[model samples]
Target: MKQMSYMINQRYMKKLTCCFVCIFLLIGTVAAQDKEVKLKIVQTSDIHGNFYPRDFILQRDAVGSLARVYAFVQKERETYKDNLILLDNGDILQGQPTAYYYNYIDTVSPHVAAEMLNFMGYNAGNMGNHDVETGRAVFDRWAGDCHAPVLGANIIETATGKTHFPPYVTLERDGVRIVVLGMITPAIPVWLSENLWKGLRFDDMEETARKWMKIIREKERPDIVIGMFHAGQDALLMGGKYRENASLDVARNVPGFDIVLMGHDHARECKKVRNIAGDSVLVIDPASNGVVVSDIDITVTLRDGKVTDKKIDGVLTETGAYGVSDEFMKHFASQYATIQDFVSKKIGRFTETISTRPAYFGSSAFIDLIHTLQLNISGAEISLAAPLSYDTRIKEGDVYVYDMFNLYKYENMLYTMKLSGKEVHDALEMSYDLWTNRMTSPDDHILLFRDKPREGAADRAAFKNFSFNFDSAAGIIYTVDVTKPSGRKVTILSMADGTPFDMNKMYTVALNSYRGNGGGELLTKGAGIPQDELKERIVSSTDKDLRYYLMQYIEGKKVIEPRALGQWKFVPEEWAVPASKRDYEFLFGKVQE
Candidate 1:
């Protein structure tokens, strides 16, 4: 009986050992299957509504269209397959006539931008500051139409105190959990009118990132975390409360993020920054207008359903390599034709030709036209205007709706603010300080130029005065003496009607909403006007944008005549006369007739 019992026990033990071995082998196989996942993240940011390769404003072929991006994405999709995720970093809902048409004009129809993005299969998108500038109705509608989640983790709803958009999204691919959190620059409240973002509150980017990272790491235990920051690389403080460009700060302060994509400032960059955890994290910015796409490749390793190791790499993919996709064009061909017809419609006629290039030198019909319209509409005592573009021209005769876009590059509203004549002098002084350099001799380069010529390029002259900020006043006669120093450069002589300019007397100044809101610091820093008081000084504001008023003003007149007010001039004609001629030819490559 004992021998029989020993034999049964030995057989039982052998069977148990075999079962354990089989279970171990099965666990090993399952672990091996879930061990690795390869993911490719493709991104487009600051695409300011360039769905096509054509420049709707210029009516010519330009770079950085969604068609070009589609071509690249399609090719990349083939390589990445289901493991790929596509995203847009924001600033898409507004910009260009194409977007403006769909945003405000064609309200009943399906949004073209959203439709295209959905059709192309974008996994997610972030709301840029400019996107918020489009107002709640426009953005809310656009976001509702997007098939993918449109996220802004920091955009809090005032009533609910919760995120207006999805704060974060988690995707599972081959057992690897990937979490993406989206945040926009909190400077929306700083730059935009409060009415535009009335229901929403923007939180600091870095702070938002930190809070989300903790939650995602603890609850989701994500294999990888990616940050889609619709902010810039710069750490510049905006409104002294938050950083406008806080991507780098987030990367350094917030831990557990494997990748961060930045936008808003429209700079192309890719680098690695060590996180607080001392692990290298990749940060990339694809720049603006669909010119480039930020590509991130993440390699994750897992063992027994747990992540063992992970690595990520980032790079910017240029859109130039891929031409416009025929497939994409076919999809949006009808909408494209509609916009073409809309922009082609004649708005008014110009009495004579005018170009913005001349505005940089002094005053020209181009900027003066804007000044005339501002002064006429606002009925202000004086006007402040600037050349919005570097090299845009409107020829004589028929002008289309498209021409209006070139005339006004941005959708800035009209603002009439109260400023003392002394304050105006200080503002113009700062404007010319950026406009001109001290000229000791006639031969010295008058226009701003590069310190060194770029290789293989002809000695290209660049401007220290970003033509957009080269403000010149109308309704007030002033002299910018190049020989004088910055603070003393602008001398206000009298009003356009020859009334004596009084220093302490308050005058209503008509300018763009951007300037009135302190864009370029011409009013706040230069004029010594307090930033907080800017809103109080506003005498009038347009319900619609200045561009809209400009179009209406032209339509009413039928025959639009734009000419230089000649209210301001560069002094010391012996030096100014020749320098203007030389610089104009150098910059625009056209002879001044």
Candidate 2:
């Protein structure tokens, strides 16, 4: 009987052991199947209010619209499933008629950017420098309306010294964690007025990044870390003393990020930077105006519920090939119509057509119109202005609000500052240095230098500096000698009224707010003035935007004609006149008569 009982016990134990083994095998199989997870992140930066497929400024079919970008995002989402997240790297709250209308005109209603971003279901967004420029009321209201987190680690609150916006956001997908840290360039104090950036302070990118990286690694323990920077790839001093663009430096210095994305100066880039641990980190910049998007794919491997391996791949995806989303257009069709009506209103009439293309080589009606308005409105002795557009033209006929957008590209205010006669001369010298190159020979290109050119290309001229920064002075008689060096290029003859312009005498000068804020270094570097001392020199400032003043000025007249002051010209006209004509014809396909 004992032997039979022992046999029964042994048989029961064998059956139990086999059942446990089968259960373990099933668990192992399931774990093996679910060990790997893939995530896709798409980034859009420097969108600059490109909501529609058409350019309201030019009144033409514009490339790189947000409607097309939405379609691309939809396709990517469909291809990658819910494992994908959409992010905007900032600079979305300003730049176009759509933005300007919703921002200033219809202030009571919801902002266009907030509505669009919420509708598109963006996961996160960073605060750009331009976003800060929109003033606290506009940006703060927009930030509140957004469904996703508006982040800016470096944008600190002056009262508490803490970030005004949320520093970072954490997302989890299929047991894998993702941490995204947002940062903006620390040059806001340099470019903007206290009214625009009140109660906020911006910090250095690399320092802020290092501090957050350590905290996130220890606390969140994320499987992937992403840095969203509203800055350019190159580390350059943009606002005189401040290094506004520093995206590349943060990626190299910060240790834990799996990927970094940036935009501000509007350059496209896609590459990798390895961390101290020898792990490769992907970095991408999608340029500006919604032209491109940064797409990233990350593969994370886990074993026994612990992350084992990770890999990331990033690229800049062009949105030009993508079609506009009908759904998006339909969603905001009414808003578009309203903006169209707003921009289409007739303000005044022009007797003759004008082009800004000639403004780069010499003074023209395009920049001179702005100068005339500046001097007339501010009632200053001298006026300074530049061509805000490269190749915009308005025909002889009725002028509309849309034409004003082409006339002045930014929402800058008119400023009158106190400058000495010597300082004004120095400013003109710097302006011409950016405008023209020293003519070593008459055969050399007069205004532009094109290093590489297509054989049959109609336009081969290229500028060393942006054409918008090529400033010209009105109300002052001056000559720019291309034969001389930079500082000695300008020879001021006298004031336009033939008054003796004494070097020791102080003169009130009318100019745009951008130049007064040291935007182009014409004041700080060229005029040998300190940046901090700029506000003290402000004799007067327009209460409204320069565009608004221009519109009011033209509307008050009802019949308007824009012409060049022609107070300043390039010397050696025998060489310059013909060269200017040839280059103008090559660039704009129009012969200068």
Candidate 3:
């Protein structure tokens, strides 16, 4: 009886031990399933091909570049490892000569923008209006060459009725899923020529965001949703017509987005916006030229394969503070050398030096040079041109290819449009209204000075409006009466050749494609032409960009002398002359002789 009892006890002890072991194993498995994940997301926007720490246009060493950004990103990667996500917010295919070189000059090779993005291991990128300005061939090739996806949820192909680029991209890290939806500003049609966008249609940001949010939540079921928008934070721009800068609008209206990244206006911002559901969403913009980047830290807690809690924080990291990466510089050294050679080639010669500073006060050789070219190239009776650069100088001597960049800042094509003589007068009235104030006394500012000057800002920042909108007309004689009001300030005297200026007749006017496309509302609002009717007025357009024609024109002339047309002047020289000098000193901090 004692032996039987001992055997039973031994068997029970063995079973109890097995049960304890099984419970411990189950506890270990549950503990492993519940985890905390930390991720770092870095974003670069409006880089504009600042690949090296050099300003190819100015031929000077500049602070912002992808080399500096690369260094900072690599340093962060050491801590985050595979948990790091890098993204670009578009406008990377314009601005610097580096982009122009690869975009048009080196047609056989892969785009430098794509090459650099791939080299930096970018997770995804979006399209910008300027990127679209590169036209179908260049941008399509760039999108194809990139290792990562180029996403634009609102850029739809008209024929297929589908997104031209991938709507979004998915990323996974340590069992966490992230979805990034990209959208460009719907204002492209308002600013860009239709041929540039061709068969693509831009949809409203709010509607696109709403559509993508539903799809992402229902299908992706991602742990986090991000918005990468090539737009500004301002919701009231253009009266929200096409929502040019709808980054804030989409964030406030869309429910599922946890974060939104913005660009296009070149303004730096970092803040949290409350959505319709009262949930806070982070929105950030790093501004332009790769000077800064958006850095975000995300902490996610998961239980039973579902996210229980999440915390997000974002800050702007100044790329200028970091040193340029030697590795990045070495890898693309050849391409950099080639671009340098291309820009250094001499195209023509200049007889005299000219500066755009005088453009704000009155007629300057700086702007007249462009006006001369446009009138000559397009055979237009009137030329409307603005000083694209607020203050840049092209010194006398041999003109290099890079000097053309200073001469003409944008890649706008030259356009000759038919405008009634009265329409031209109204346009000039609008331009001067934006450019100068209606002075009641000599003490009043001549230029439209801001009510409160921005401290330590560029000289142009002191103005009430962008200086690029300050258009002056050549090929016509006119006078601006400063004592009068906005509508009555401009007075048309006669044509530059002393022909009668008839308001009833239509005249050929030469302007950039930007203005022709109603970029600043000069044609639509001032000229009283319907937005849709502006296209009908186009008499002709150059095959290449204005800069190309300007270069060719200069080369043909060999040694060109640029002079102001002296066709227009400000009346009541007593009040105008002193005010002009005072305003020039106030803006430029230098007294005119």
Candidate 4:
């Protein structure tokens, strides 16, 4: 009987030991499931084709580039590995000669922009207004070539009522699901020509975000939702619909977004805004040119396959601190050589040196050259042009293709639009209102000076408004009286050929597409043309960008001289001359001898 009891006790002990082992195994599994997962999301916006450290236009070393960004991203990937998410917020199709060459010149090869993004392992990208400005063929081809998805939730097809690009992309890492919703600024129609964004309509950010958030929550049920917007943070009413910079508005009004990344205004911002549910959402922008990147680290705690808690930290990391990635440069060496060769080719020769500096105080050869091109190409009676660059100079010598970039800053096509002579006068009035100040005395500032420059402001900070909007006429002679008020400052004397200026007469005017499309409101606000009617006035438009035509024009001329038209000047020379000199010194820190 004692032997039987001993055997029974051993069996009981064995069963008890088995129970304890099972409990231990269960606890281990639970602990593993309840642990934390970390992810790093890096964003680059408004890179504007600064792929290399070298400035293709200036032929000098620049501080920011995708080469440097790649170096920084490489280091970050060492820690995050598969958990690292890389995204680009558009405007990649314009700016440098590299993008221009790939966009227009090289039609057969895979765009270098796409190749670079793929090589850098970008997870996704968003379309920018400028990308749309490249027209459907270029952007569509670029999107098709990229391995990662190009998302644009708010860009909808007009015909089908469907999103033009993929609305969002779902990414999974370490059992955590992330949803990235992309949207571009809805102000594309205001700044871009209709043909550039044909068959597509930009939707409001707030409405689109609300719709996408509901779909994502009900369908995707993602652990985290991110907003990748190619818009600004500020909320400004544009075109009587959605705000142009609606990133901040979407973050505050919409729910379920864990983070929002913004661009397009070229302003750096980093802050946390509370959503409708009172949850903290991080909004960040690294500004433009790849000088900085938005770096975000997210730690998510999960239990039983469900997220219990999350911690997010964001910062703007400067790429200037990092060196250019050697691998990145070596891989794209051939493309770089091609762009270099393209920009370096001699186009023609300049008889005299020209600078945008004189264009501000009075007429200058720099702007007149553009006016000459426009009038000659469009056969317009009046030419409206501005000093696109605030302070850029081209010396007297052989001119390369790169120098054309300095001559004309944007890829705007030349436009020939019809306007009444009175409308032209009013447009000049508004231009001068934005450009000059009402000077009571000669000592007062000639150019409108800002009371105080905004924090972290760069060039053009001293001025009250944008230098690009300071338009001056070349085909007509006029004088701006400083003593008069804003509306009464400009006085049109006669046409360039001394023909009597008639306010009732309708005249053909040559201008850039940007102004023609009501970019600066010069046509709509000053000229008093309704926004809808501006398109009807387009008499003709160039087949290519103004810069391309300017190059061809220069090449055809072989040897050209650029001189100011002397068609316009400031009146009351005593007050104007002294004020102009003072303002020039104040703006550029030196006076032209």
Candidate 5:
């Protein structure tokens, strides 16, 4: 009788276990159905023409190859019911070799690069500040050939008050509306000059977002709102350790925004940001220049009358951990191998030492070379070249065409603008103030050059690179007194005919369009002058690019030589900041307060 009771208890326990399994399976089925509404978003930021693996300067091993990205994006889209969209946050041109041109490449158009990206498939992107460095023409070319939408909400043609590129794009996926609003950094005037952005203005970002989001929400009523912003990430928790930067500023203030995709700071951030109204905006910015990509899948819940919670799925890995396309890698390797020989060579050395002292006046031969090139080729009456090159690897007497190109990586137009001596004086004074504030305060800074100085010292690593006493071939002359302080540093300004500078009279000064429209504060144009430094009416200003001019100057031959442009001569007597010094505070003499 006891044995019979034990068998009966075992049978009852088995029945109970079966009942629990059935209930569990039913719950899991519902959960799976809920998650099936998830959306996949594939993002790329700061691609900046990094269509291929490792660029000229960034010679990292196994750094890049779009094959991995392409395959991954395809697989993800396929997995997510073909609902995936790829986006570039910003800065896709001028950083790499592409269907574009920079001062770094010798009339070499990035044809293969353009085709490669077209094949890989990009849906849309924002216009980075560096993208403007390509100027309007190349932008036209790249856009004409691209299969994606290049967007910018605030960037405008000042003449028309209309957006130069599309402000936003909306795609209807099944029963969902995904709206992607693009926003570029308003810091264009800070990084690039006014000349490159002729007839353009970057509107207030906050205001633009408010207006666009409102319009899109009201008219299209997109099911999802995504902001493709090219902004830096926030500071690290304790130290400046890597942290994601998506100016949640827009997310918090701008209503109806669902996600913010940010770039420009070169950080990989994938997380949920809480706005002021207690709404969650998904933000992601993969590492810059094709180092990494962030994949995020999203799901929305709205069971009640009011909107409910949204979810972010974990990032799917591609490229970095897993290898990229073998064919793409093979092609990139072959071309890079050929280009490496030229970039790696050290040309010649400086017999005389160089300097970048007194801030306002000229200091380095690198500056002189730029001025000489601009002046010699354009044959302008006067030309001014600021120190655009950074990280001078050229030891004394060792300079290569590659080194020169590396220093000046942008291709901007040369222009001759009419300006009174007073305006020129003001610009120089501004540069002085910037230099002084940069050196003394060190902490309080705004200008790009003042902040990090590229290689920790733009003027130092860039300016004092090699030495020369080059004569100005552009019919311009100036003198500098190193003994004087910055405000009163400049001396004689002898013209093409050795005439004195007339402050009240208009003089046609030749310079890159970037400087003419005030790329740097040192070159701001006056109120009446054309906003674009390279606007037509000035002689030869309406013509070709600096690279083309350089090509014509060289005539397909080796012609770069050490020549000093006597645009400004500095006195060796006064003590100025040394290029070798890292600390800037000591460089600026304390005020007599």
Candidate 6:
């Protein structure tokens, strides 16, 4: 039986080798059609650690493997019969099991992701916030070994102005001169680790893009111009101007460009924007992590004075416009097989449902994960977990390490703050207010909106309930009942030893520097705290990459069961619904009218 099985395996191996050769052969012969140079461009945005279908777990039926992407691209090219251009919108590194397991180890790095990208035909890539999360040294190495160009126009080293990554590149495919320019989101301060960008300077995206626009126009003038930007509609093209104006504000302002692919905010555009001059500048963006691919077919028109209008057969430009494919998924699995196994061992199951609810006011599944980790890592009596609600739901069976990092994506440092009960409550209120405000104004900033509150303006009362998650502070415990008004949510606050929060005494609370410095405006606003001053304040971001550190720790652990920290509860009554809006609960939690 063993001999027979071995022979069968050898035969299968030969067949697979033949298939691989055939794929390459087919890729090589792909030529521009007679009428036009039909080319396909595949782009992905904000793919944070969601590489495999079953996450990093080595599961077959799960979706979103890069191999599937490759297969899809191949199939598209076969049908379209066009030249191909593959562009990544950035935020590629540190998104999936690949970034978590191997990229962190330095044993395997972004080169691994890039290599897979290159083997599968990624022509050009850009820098994402998460890419910088790994630090410059690792990024530099990854850039050195990359198969495609890593691009950013404005990002320059502080001590030296040399770019950390390439700004743009011009390529020729199917007799069409295509110029691709790169721009990363300018939100460096908000998303990146201070250490990674300490001395570096990332200028206004438009200024940098314009400067490159002229350089490329004069030096590398091409037939078609395309922008590969990490900044998206919210940052740049918020459609109509609002309070904050950003670089994409200049996308239309730039001359000598045809189409632009955008990222950063990870929003799919409503449609292509046309300049006042009547030039339709095609623009496209796919939602993060290869969920959907945007396809655009470019056709040019030119004529002499005699011929009024002529439809000149040009290039048929294409990108990812569909779903997961078996071929792409299978190849992606084989390449990252090492990473797949290293992250997907069973982490145990949850007997209860975990959610990101109460994210607006009190605590959540996302918040619960944070506190539990901080308490465990720092061994602090009170661990502070800053609320950054993304995706949630921890169920039975194998949970990938990649999922763990996504729940706590930031490379933030954990610090402890000593505050009185009042101080803690005040800070909680402030964070809650920010959460509510962010939800209310959810256009360019919030791509995720599972939590929202209706008070509209600055309502100091968002903090009526100062409930701490069981995981929010390990050595501490608290409960909140929505039956009471907003501020009085917390009826009891006590230490693990059963000591209540005393007005005269102080307690040590652990949290991230972003919270301590009061980025959330909760503690910064001094809301509800009728005190003379803040007890103590200290700020620390991160030294080693926190995301990478977490990934390394998970591989060694027996299990990482994420659970719901039973802290806050909903009011018995439902909130009033605004006739102006749709299902209000989808945005804001059910408000008690």
The lDDT of each candidate is: 0.85, 0.84, 0.89, 0.90, 0.57, 0.55
lDDT per residue (tens digit) for residues 116-152 in model 4? 9999999999999888888888999899889999999
Model 6 lDDT per residue over 1-593, tens place: 99999999999999999999999888655532133444556676666655555555223344444544565677767765547677777777765556655555655434667666666677788887667766776666766777878888878877888776778888876556678888776655433345666777676677777788888878876777778777666542211122122434655777556777766554455355665456656666665655556555554322221212222222222223445556555655654667656655544444444454444434455566666666666565566565443324444445555455545555555555666666666554443333332222213222112233312111121223222211233455665333333355444467666777565566666666444444333454533332223223433333554554455555556456665565543222132113112223543446521
Report the C-alpha lDDT of model 3 over 468-512, residue by residue, as the tens digit.
888999999999988899789999999999989999999999999
Question: Which regions of candidate 4 are displaced past 4 Å?
Answer: 1-29, 449-460, 591-593
Q: lDDT at 334 for candidate 2?
A: 97
lDDT of 2: 0.84
lDDT (10s digit) by residue, model 2, range 238-272: 55657767778878777888888888767677899
Q: TM-score of every model? A: 0.91, 0.94, 0.94, 0.94, 0.66, 0.68
Clashes of each: 0, 0, 0, 0, 19, 29
For candidate 1, which ten residues in a row score worst on lDDT?
Answer: 452-461
| Clashes by residue pair, model 1 | none
Cα lDDT for residue 49, model 1? 84
Candidate 3 or 1, higher lDDT: 3
Task: For model 2, name the residue pairs that clash.
Answer: none
All models, RMSD in angstroms: 3.6, 2.9, 2.5, 2.3, 9.4, 16.5
Candidate 3 Cα misplacement greater than 4 A, ranges: 1-34, 236-241, 450-460, 591-593
Worst 10 residues of 4 by lDDT: 453-462
As for candidate 3, its clashing pairs are none
